[model samples]
Target: MTPRIGLILFTALLMQCENPVKTPLPGAETIPAQIRQTDCFNGGNALFHAARITEMGNRASGTPGYRRQIDYLKEELAKYGWTCREQGFEKETPQGPVRFVNLRARFGKTPNFLDPVRGLLTCHIDTKQGIDGFTGANDGASGAAAILETARILSGEPARAGNLELVFFDGEESFAEHMDSDDGLYGSRHYASAMQQPLPKWMINLDMVGRQGKKIRIPSMTPQ
Candidate 1:
C-alpha cells in the first residue's frame, strides 16, 4: 500500500497568536533554490482560492455556505475535465439531523463503483459551527485551496500513474462547543461505511496547510 500524504494548514491566527515572527529553519540556504520558488507549489494561487472561500463565511454542515463551497469545488473540478459527484448523508447532530455531502471528483473514465482506486486525496470543507468570526480560513479553506492547486497541476499533466479520486468532505467539524467522537468526522465516517470496494491504498488527507511565515510541524505518523 502506498503511504498517504496528510497536509495540515495551520491558521495565520495561530501563528500570530503564538509569535509574530517565525523562526527560520537552520541551514535554510542549503536547501535547493527550486524548493523556495513560488512556481513550485504556487502557494500564491492557493492563497487566492483560500481567500475566496473564506469570503463565504462559516461553512457549517447543511448550511448555504457549505453548499456554495461544494458548488465552487464542482465547477472548478469540472473545468479541469474532472467528473464530480456528491454523496449525501444525514447525521444526528447536537442541533438536529443535518445533511452532509462528500464531494468527490475523478479524472479520465469513471471507475466502476465496485473497483478499487489506487489513490485518494481528501480534505474537509466544512467549518466549525457557531463560532463567531470563524471562517475556517486556514483550517478548511487553505486545505481546499491546496487541493485545488494540486488538482489543477495534475489534471494538466500528460501522465498520471493510477486511478485517483479527490474528496472534499463536509460535516468534519462538530456543531457543539467541544467535539466528542460522535460529533465530528461525519463525512469520512459515512464514506467509509458506504464504500463497496476496497479503499484506496494511498490516501492523502489535507488540513491546515497554508499560512504565511509559519513552519509546518509534520507529525511522524504514516501508515506502514
Candidate 2:
C-alpha cells in the first residue's frame, strides 16, 4: 500500500535531513562531449529491463534466490570495474530490528569516506513480497542495469574520473508484506547514513522501465 498524504510528508521530512555532500574531483565534468548521441540511453534501458525481470524472480532478502541475485550482480559489475561492497544494516520496527542490505559500486577511491561523486545512479534490487515473488520486472533491476550500462558509455571519459556511483539497494521492498517508510527503502536510507555519499548533481531513479506505454506522472505538474 502507498503511503497516505500525511505519511508521505512525514517520510519526506525524514529523508530531507541535509545529507552531507562530498566535494567534486578536480576538473570534473558532467557529460562527455563525444557521446554518439544516437539513443544510446536506449540500450541501457533495455539492460535495465532484463535485469529487473531476472531479479524479480527472487531477491526478497535472506533467501537463497536473493543470494544468487546478489552474486550474479557482483560478478557482472566487477566486469565493469566497480569496487563493490555489501554493507548490511538492521532496521527497527514494531517487530524489532530486521536485517537489510545495500550494494555499493564505486568507480575509484575517494579522498574521504564518500567519494566526491559527480553523479549518483541508483535502483532498488529487491522485489515486493506479496506479488508472486515480485519479479520486480521493472522495480529495482532496471535502474541498476541502467547505471552499469552508463558506466560503460562513460569509460575513459573525464566525466567518469570521479564521475559515477551506482547502488543496487536491497530491502526497497518493505517488511511484513508491504512497503511503508517504517519498512521499505531501507537499504537507501541505511546507505545514505553509513557510506555518506556525496550529493549527486543529478539523480535519476527508474522503475517499471520495460512496461509498454510507460508514462511518468510528475509532482506539481512540472517536467522532471
Candidate 3:
C-alpha cells in the first residue's frame, strides 16, 4: 500500500476516541461554562472561509493561485495572534525539481522560548495538478478552512494554543496522474525529515473533510 493510504488508516484508528465528535476541547474544565456554551466551533464561519478560498481558483504548487492562498492564510492567521513562518524546500518530481512552501504557525506574535508542542494539526493547501479549473473546494480548501477555524477557536485558549502547531502543506497532489513515493507528499516529507527532537505527541491531518452529509464513525473500543 502507498504511504498516504497507510497514514490514513493510522489516523482513522487514532480518531476512534469515545464520543469523538462530542468530546470536550482539551482543558475544557478550566474554561468558564458560559464561554464553553457560547464560544465554540463555528461551522458557518468555516464554510465561509472554505468558499472564499475556493473562489481563489486553482492552487496548484508553484502557481499564482497557490501564492494567493498562502497570502490569505497568513493574513487571517495574523488576526488571531498567531505567528506564521514558511518552510520552503525543493524536491525532484517526475517532471522536474519544484519548490514547495509549507506554512507553519504558532501562538503568540513572538514567542521567546522554544516550547515543545504536544499536538499538530495539518492539511494540504495545494490543489491537484492537471485538472483544468479544479478549485479543490472539498479536497484542499475545506481542510484549510477547518484549520483556520480551529486556529480562531484556539486563540482564546493560550495554554492550548501554546501546546499545538498548525501546518498548511503544499505539493500534496502529484504532478502525474498517479502518486508514487517520489512524485507526491513533497511538503509533508520535507517537514518530516526536517523535524527536530521532541516531536509532537499526536497529529491530525485533515483532507476532503468539507463534503456534505459525510458521516464519521468511531470504533466501539475507543478510549474515553
Q: How high is the lDDT of residue 127 in model 3?
A: 94
lDDT of 3: 0.78
- Per-residue lDDT, model 1, residue 40, is 36
Task: For candidate 1, give the lDDT of residue 168.
Answer: 93
lDDT of 3 by residue, 150-171 (tens): 7887788998788788999999
* TM values, all candidates: 0.78, 0.66, 0.80
As a whole number from 0 to 100, the lDDT of residue 40 in candidate 2 is 35
How high a TM-score does candidate 3 get? 0.80
Kindly give the number of clashing pairs for every candidate. Answer: 8, 3, 0
On a 0 to 100 scale, what is the lDDT of residue 41 in model 2? Answer: 39
RMSD of 1: 7.7
lDDT of 2 by residue, 53-172 (tens): 474376676666677777767776665455677888777854567677777777643323255665556778777665764566567666555555555544445344345566778877
Off by over 4 Å in 2: 1-56, 93-97, 108-113, 156-158, 195-198, 213-224
lDDT of 2: 0.57
Error (Å) of candidate 3 at residue 178 is: 0.4
Q: Rate residue 84 of model 3 by lDDT.
A: 91
- Number of colliding residue pairs in model 2: 3
